[model samples]
Target chain A: MSEVKDTQGQLWEVFIQTKKGLPFKHFGSVHAYDKEMAIQNARDLYTRRGEGRGMWVVPADAIVAIDSSDDESFFDPSNDKVYRHPTFYELPDGLKNM
Target chain B: MDNLNLSKFCIRLGDHCLIMAHRQSELCSNGPFLEEDIAQINLGLDLLGQAEALLIYAAKLEGGTRTADDLAFRRPERQFHNFMLTEQPNTDFAFVIVRQYIMSLYLLKTYQALSKVEDDTLSGIALKALKELTYHERHFAMWLKRLGDGTEESHERTQTAINELWMFVGELYEEDEIDFMAQKASYAPTGIEMKTFLMEHITAKFSEATLETPHSIYMTTGSKKGIHTEYLGYLLTEMQYLQRAYPDAKW
Candidate 1:
């Protein structure tokens, strides 16, 4: 019964999965008065051309993001960590599906 | 009935979708919001696709040089046989949703029955149309509920639309002479059964939306018999303008 409308509409971010077992990718957002209409809007907007097999809608306000403007405080610590990269290690020769 | 009769009936069916598409396109870039605009366009596109296939089949059945384009653009207002409900003016968003909701529900029942007809081509068309119709019915249904239960003005506007358009609902269920013949040949379903299903679904949806239903039992008919409202003339004037002004025009 998630619903949105013109009067009390809330913005919902849309995620679409093109196939089963695939990750849902963020497409965009739509304002809807109810959950049903939100999903309908997503289907019409995001999947009209059979672009996706599944969809997830969450209120825009539900998402929390790290403050990107202050990049050095958090994300920068991992930006140049070459040891964390798989390419940094040499794989044993001929390791299939590794 | 003869092939001519069957074709005539097919024209009526095609006209419903074509006219509805024509009317809804009037809302292009005029929707309440961007998402709404996109939704309306998708709905119109679906109607347009269905119209093209049905009219193509109709033109072929007529066994003449006439094409779907000819039937769509060249026919005078009197020759076009679309439901009065579909040819209605888009007075407001509420009206558009209500009128569309009614037609979509009607289509859902009729198309489902039509998909099983003895004629493979027509049945295939019905199957394709039903998939499109499924989304259409839901789109309008969702809007109808939102408008009917939203604001006082919205509720009032929607109720007025339903009251104004309810009288025409009878015509969708009426089996005309050609329709009866099509039913006998298993090319189409009986309108009465579809009407019953439509009414039940409409009633349930109305209650959920908190919308009022018109009590008027008086019915209006004539579109199927080549008679139409004054609105149709104006609509045709705009829709056929490009083709009429420039014969053999192409995109």
Candidate 2:
């Protein structure tokens, strides 16, 4: 009856909410054969009291991870380019809300 | 039974939380890693919080000078009524998972039933606790499935845990006259059967996990009456040491 073993389950990410009016932030990952199983696992892993409103379980392989080595050239130059900081320029009080 | 009798009943519920919280507390700084360690510790805190609220209610019902602390620290092992399931030593991750899985299911059912209690305080406590326990159930249930379906080693260990612990599930439903009294008093639901619900949920969970269900007829008893397995005494000793040693030492 063990058609698909536990080991064959795929990894899926989870998100959760701690209470009402909360967002379902990324919580953790669980392994399951399909989306339905993944959602169930996510419910077990993420929601307890109804702690989670919703969750999205993407296969572990589907995520394109950014390489750590590209940290310098990828974004370091932006630090010296102060123009990117919107806070650097003071806007008049008329545009304060904007 | 009168409210005095009901106090004893509430204490039994408190004892369940206190003992389990005490067991979970040992995990502080001893979790597998930072996140897991924090999670277990948080779980311990939550269980203790639940115990505190229930015991305080019990103290009020008794119409005596005793407080929650008295019940928590001064009570003997034989006086503390909790299920044997919560009292079992967390021998490994497998045991921990099994304990959480079983307790979560029980708490979910218990709190849901208790939410409609006539007592405003009891209903409030149940309402708050119900939210927390829902998460507890989900967390352990997910892990049970993962570990059951994970590596061969993990699967084997978890299956062993399930088989070993299966006998204790019976205690969750073993109600007596006291429970019936509580039901009649509107302290809890009347004829609320937990066995069928528990069995169905666990059976489905095990099936999904591909874990073999144990067939042992040796169901442990006496937890409802405050009698316990051998492990409870040692657990109570450590748990009560502070209060026992320094009587009235509290904030």
Candidate 3:
């Protein structure tokens, strides 16, 4: 058994997919003793109303996240690149598939 | 099929769920861990839902002024047909999980059989219940393995629980005269057949848990006839307190 690290067992980040082929969006987090319990607890906490068709749970500690302090360094450079967006070009009114 | 027997059968199943769900629900704020507390509460709610559905079906088949509420609340101690095992006290978490494991195994077999039957309502309910029971069975089964093999105290506590609760397993297979009639009319499954699956699965799991198979020949009987341990009356007192105190109370 994993040592009881804290009152709320291991923190697991939960992601839920509403239907098949849908991307698993971050739903919330749950506390559980281990991987299976994490999935079960995630199911109970996140899927009570049948809101999910698929679920993924990862340990919160396993994630690698950029600090908020790095926001300027990571994403600020892309802000001025309006040409990278589809709206930069105007499409013909009759171009249905475009 | 005879309406009396069929309703009685439904009530029997309902009573088991109701009584056991009550036990599980009592742990709402008492679980060893927060996650476990929530998980068990969810399980209790699932059983409560299953009980209500079955009880409503029972009331419907009985075809009288008696509603599901009346059947569930107004009934006296002797009228309930839940197993003695279910009404047994939650001595500890190990016993609780052991009790759930036993009942879940029986319920899995029972509902699986029920899901295959012809009655639309019963089959539909069983099918729905099977989905929930899958997770419930897994939850307790994992607990059994965890507790049975974890620390020395956990292993000992759970091992004793298995032995203590093993006697109650016989009552689950104890068929009544009405049960025979129901089975003959294709209204119910042969419980003995269900026990075969339960025993096989239980033995394998128990062995994996490093627990000895209970070889004790002592078998506690007499729950289907509304006979139960001292636990049932006390359970009823708490369960029926609201209804008894305030008749027809509703949200």
Best by the TM-score measure: 3
Candidate 1, B1-251: lDDT as tens digits: 67787788778889999999988799889988878888898899889988998899989989978999999999999899999999999999988999999999878877877898878888998999999999898889888888888899999999999998888899888886787787787766688777778879999999899987777799899988889888999999999999999999899
Tell me which of candidates 1 and 2 scores higher on DockQ.
1
Give each model a TM-score. Answer: 0.92, 0.76, 0.93
Q: Give TM-scores of chain A for all candidates.
A: 0.76, 0.67, 0.80
Clashes of each: 9, 6, 0
Candidate 1: which stretches are off by over 4 Å?
A: A1-8, A79-81, A88-98
Whichever of 1 and 3 has more TM-score, that candidate is 3
Model 3 score (lDDT): 0.87
Candidate 3 CAPRI category: medium
Model 3 Cα lDDT, one tens digit per residue, B1-251: 67777888899999989998999988988988777888899999999999999999999999976888898889999899898999888899999999999899888887887888788999998999999999999999888888988899999999988888889889877787877876786656687786788789899988888877888879988887777889899999999999999999988
User: Per-residue lDDT tens digits of candidate 2, residues B1-251?
Assistant: 68887788778877878888888888877765444565676677778999999999999888868988888889898888898888898888888988888888888887887798777898898899997888777767877887899899999999888887787787888878898887776665444467777778888898898887776778888987778889999998898898888887877
Best by DockQ: 3
- Kindly report which residue pairs in candidate 3 clash with one another: none
Question: lDDT at B63 for candidate 1?
Answer: 95
